[model samples]
Target chain A: MNVPLLQVRNLTHSFLEGEEKVHALRGVSFNANQGEITSIIGPSGCGKSTLMYLLGLLDQPDSGEIIINNNSISKLNEIQKTQLRNEKIGFIFQFHFLIKELSARENVALPAIKKGEDSEDALERADQILNQLGLSEKLDRFANKLSGGEQQRVAIARALINSPSLILADEPTGNLDTANSEIVFDLLQRLSREQNLAVLLVTHNNQLARRCDRFISMNDGLIVD
Target chain B: MTMSLIGIIFGISFFIVTQAQTSGFQTYFIRTILGTNGAIRISDRFQDMKGTVNKISKDGQFKFQFKSREDAEYIDGVDYPGKIRNALSEFPSINGISEVFECNAALQTKSRNYSVQAHGIRINDHMIASEIENQLMHGSIENFLSDEMGIFIGNRVAERLNLHVNDRVNIVGKKGNFQLRVSGIFETGVSEIDKKRIYISLATARSIEGKRFGGSVFQLSMFNPDNARSVASQIQQTLGHRTVSWQEREKVWLDVFKALRISSAITVSTILLLSGLGMFNVFAIMVIEKTRDVAILRSIGFEPKDISAIFLWQGMIVLIAGIVGGVLFGVIGTYLVSQIPLEIRGIFTTDSFVVNWDISHYIWAILIATIFVSIASWIPARRASKVEPAKIIRETI
Candidate 1:
């Protein structure tokens, strides 16, 4: 196949601890194809999150080449990195992290607003997305007023506001109950298929990982297929 | 937020009161001088004239004539002969006509003789000054008119001359030596005039020079002190003679105002700078505390301009709110304070000094100070726009 949508090669990352050295990621590599749901699973401290951060361009690897859409983004400047991230990537965090001051619809429309969309249009789109997530009635509710699952849904709507091509979820369902977790996982899978987006989700749940098209297990700092 | 706004309001109010006090002093000075002297003085243009101001000789006299054919005919037939006669006859009749002449006097002090200001004051003119008169410490002004050689002196002059009321003083003028009795003293709160000048009745100034109702100068008073300048000019035009308004007559107050302006500007700038620094700290802290929010905004696609605009709008809101609260409190507080008796008000007045705050100064103070604060808030707002989304998000999370 042509180059994967995202490719990581020989990614190595480490940190210093006083006199000691701690290696977080060691020359690991992974390729995630377009329009596929790829999950990365590992225990805590195995550097799974670190690898994901590097791949997401939220952190840099000491030695690695990260290619997105067949362009090696390892050399991109901060402005270019931010531009690419804003234009092509979306993130879903376990905490939701919706701004407390804004209403549910405003939280969801935030990304669209950042993209310079008209406020009314962004609000309309946010309402539409919230409705799809069964949150139409809570559009005006403040973020703090929402339930955990409702808040997570609002966050998902925010991530989708720019219609980004790739979605990165880090334990998106970590704080939810089994039922809410299943529901959120199901929604993520459905959104990937509906929007034809490439999704990479990191989770400790074997069941959630199994639902993706493919799963890569990380041990220590290396990925095992 | 309201408490913070209150703080800002208090700051603005302090500034307003300070400015009002200073401006009040200035207004008080101007009014005191204008009240003591004539609202306008039509004088001769001497080296001391400075600008359009003219100083008529102190002995200058005034007389009134009517604008009527018969009266004009009588006046020309009796008083003026030649060209003045023909002109007087040509006019139908003229009211407020005055023929002024000069009386030069050389004042003898213990050390030397110096030129002293003298005025020819008629009974009506004497009454005008008498209305504003206060204790002069020695002689009565009525004594000045009792004898052509007599003159009135103020407390300041009595102190300086080493003489008391009714004391004999010798005056050597162009007309010759005349010993005069000290007359009723008058004090108008003008230290310079009180100490340096003496007053004489129109009859005395005219008589000493062997003259009857003729002076080279005339001082004019207007219905409104505020419009004295314009009226004086109109009178000058009407009489076809030069004139000087109160402002032109007294330039010391103008210099005083200029100095006051500089000092006031310095005072205002210091207050504004303090408030601005306070606002800056507030804005900087707000920005620093909201770093994560700024990152969130940036991640969501907020341009730097948008971020700046939000803060700018917030600052503007704060400014407007503070100014409104400040002005409301300042005006009301000053009014309430002014209503109290001076003795009671002295409690707040420092060292027994009280300045009744004027409303106009209070309003202007808030406006100017708030504009300074708004400008001060811009620096932090600009710094806020430089916040990094990725760095803030990663670090904060």
Candidate 2:
């Protein structure tokens, strides 16, 4: 058996709201393998986004051990975490968070550029990714000028530019119409199967969650099933 | 950014123009002072005139001595004056030397008598070495030199005595009184010199002082007046006489000039600092406005230092543009100021304003401005780099 791409053991986190302590997660344990789409679905305030933040290395859990590619990340320094994030994980957000001033290709190329890739090569790779995502005609359009679906596709292209081993997307199609939503979910599923990438998606859409390879439902910050 | 750049331009251009103008004024003042007084002056007190003169022969070489009615002992003059002259003549820095015979006397007009300092000079040689001859107000130096008892009076002396060219005045010396004609009037622009000094011929001076006062001092002009201190020291060491350089003689004025230069530097530095603060505020506002963009950049794996560099590069570009534009504007403004026909009257009268086109001022202005801009930009850049991407993203969502 291949080693799991991600492993979280006994993760726990909480914060104080004025006079009351609110526990966001309580000793949650999870694991994800390569070439699999793990959909995390839950009701509001179920700590789904909280779990995603911890998994993405954007926050440190109060008590937990996170292992990515068999390297423990719980004790990693900020710089090491940043390096790991840059080299091993990619992220997509609900709002499409594209830099409005940049063109579609430039937006896609930003992550590769930040990773210290050559400008010419980064730009060429961005073009190839956009073309593969059926955005060849919109490569030169500014992020603000693109349609809702095109902008989401550009955001997806930016995430894929680094070619990371794991993709963590939080509501990647939450703002899209039904047709664009289907298209985006199909693209994520196909990319996971074809590229052998481990994908963890947080969503409230039951129809989309059912289509993922494995679905984990959460309630009161614990994985009930 | 535009406002910050404008501030830098104003600061730099103001510094450049003021430096040029101040330097021009200082140069003119120094040159005028040097023109009235030679670069160096060597003189002797001759306290023991009798003992000094007894050691020399009554030969043609040493011709005169300082005589007083009360002192029975007297010397003929400086023994072998030619030997001292010849010793100083060999110096390559010496441009020319003028023999100066000086005495304290009283001038009497019809109504009043006033104390005066009388200078007896070899007219042609003195004219070649000093600027007094060229500053004549009423008559020519040639005319002043032609008469046996002719005198050139300063403007203030002529005015106070109500005298003019061709008016005869009586000069009372220690030994005798001599009648002299005011052949010319000159203005040196120095109030002390113009009010009390009178120039006469060497022959007339000898007659009034009983033929015992030859040249009492030597005024030396140098090829480069700035080297006067070293040259004066050499002359003093060589001849054992007292020597004073122009810088030492006008130390008070030089001190004033130094103070003015220091104050100008302080003013320019303050202006540059204020411009830097203005730049800092502009960048700070830019960072604040782009908070979300910074968050996204951070999320995409751009290090904090890289984010800082981007903002710093923007500031540097603005600073460079400001410096270049300011230098060009300063040069043009200086040129315009130089063309204006403005006359200034102080210790001397300048016919027109002058501007010094010194390149060092330009370079120093640019260097100072750059340093200030870098400091200003770095502070805001560091703040921008510390922005938390997760917090901003969560808040915005």
Candidate 3:
């Protein structure tokens, strides 16, 4: 009975939209375990990104308990949340937000550098990770020169550089064409399986969602299935 | 960023070089002028009766047309030296005073007659200790005290007459021709003084002028030369004589130097102010343009302080480079400025430009640049730090 990698209990959130309180989430609860990919599918305004933001410790929930590694996060301040975000979680976005000026390897090394690792060691680790992801030849290419699939793979390498237990990827393949989407999905699947890491992916692609180990569907901010 | 660095470099170099040159020129000009001119001079009113007669009438012509009559003769000098010497104690800044007799005479050599202005100074009165000491090229003022017939000749006059220390020359005075020995030769740097002036003992001047009491002028030196005007005014009121300060005697040159000082200050200040503003503009635009990157950096676990440091380091890099480059360029510019030959001919003289190599100016430039650049950079850095990562990431990114 190992502790769950990420836990959310009775999560709720709202926003002020034109003088009206719009509830985004209501009592949404779930657990993502280690070594499993959890797929969350929803349409626009379904609060999937909001849930991702909350679970990543990017925003505090209106009412809920988020526990990472069995340590409660509801009471953490911004500094503590930043430290936790740096050490315990990884993030990937739909657009593959890599700094365009940096090389692929340097992009991957940033998180490790921010975590107080020596730059040389961080860069060496980045080189190893990029090599493992089959970007060995393209390690020195700037992010803008890489194709959609290559850029997304580089983002995955950056996310794995710090060795976090859980990854929150919001629509990781939303902008990719079908062939490249399949290739990136396959790569994520292989990496998740091989690394024994948990991934909570928010997406609208049902075919890819069904490939995950666990599925959670949402509409209007509430869990449907 | 490069523009900002350039601005700072020019600003700092301009400040240092301008101040150094200004100080040097001012010192040189003041020394040249004060070498021959006393800080304050009290000369007897030679034209009092003549001026009154002309002012009361029109051009000394009494419209009343007085019939021919005899007039009493009057001497044109201070006949009471003891009375004036007692009045000088009222000046708090007075350091030394000497009576000088001035008259136009012809220096008669074997085959030449050169008209020269003779200044008769007391060699033992300590007046030459400061004023003439800077201009002494050969022999000493004490030579005049030892030899009653000794005279100090200007280097130019010496060159003209082929005269040296212990050489004898005859001067044709008002009533008689007196033979004199050259005791010392001084070069006052000004062409007027070096070419036409000579110094003799006051006792000899009185004997030649047939006076038993006083000379025409009382030359006074002060510990602080800047106190001349006020001291002149006070003494003029108390002693009833025509008093003149060195500032008034060379008003044109002094006013020009003051204007130069003011213009240099304004120019340097404007340059530094604009440089600081340029730095501010550069960093502000940098922060604004990098909004998306700020969000991305924040999302990657960079705190507000770290983000701010990125911008601060950028500004500091420019500042450090600018300071070092500016100082190097300033020293070189100062040296180059010093090499330029100056051709000023009238009151002041210098062969090449003088540059005061002052270390304090360099320290001052660095300190002021640091303050300006830090303020210019800090505002933008604080702005960068307060950037809301969530808003930019969600909306803009």
DockQ top scorer: 2
Ranking by TM-score: 2, 3, 1
| Model 3 alpha-carbon drift over 4 Å, by segment | A10-23, A60-63, A186-196, B33-128, B131-134, B137-146, B155-178, B190-197, B202-259
lDDT of 1 at A192: 82
* TM-score of every prediction relative to native: 0.62, 0.76, 0.76
Query: Retained native contacts per candidate, as fractions?
Result: 0.25, 0.40, 0.30
Q: What is candidate 3's CA lDDT for residue A165? A: 86
Where is model 1 more than 4 Å wrong at Cα?
A: A1-3, A12-23, A54-57, A60-63, A71-80, A219-221, B31-117, B120-292, B302-313, B328-397
lDDT of 1 by residue, B1-397 (tens): 4544666677667666655655655565666666556565444322222233334556774343323211121111112212332332343322122223346675565655655555555534445533334434555445654566667665566666666666777666666556777776666556666665667765566666666632345444444567766766665445433456777776776677668766866765566566667777888998998887787666545667778887888888878888888888776665555454543211011222235556666666666766766776788889889886655665554
Docking class of 3: acceptable
Weakest lDDT window of 10 consecutive positions for candidate 1 chain A: A50-59
- In angstroms and one decimal each, the interface RMSD of every candidate reads 3.1, 1.2, 1.5
Error of 2 at A134 (Å): 1.9
By lDDT, the best candidate is 2
Q: For candidate 2, write residues B36-120 as lDDT tens digits.
A: 7788887753344333332345674655543332343423333445676798889999887877777778899999998889888
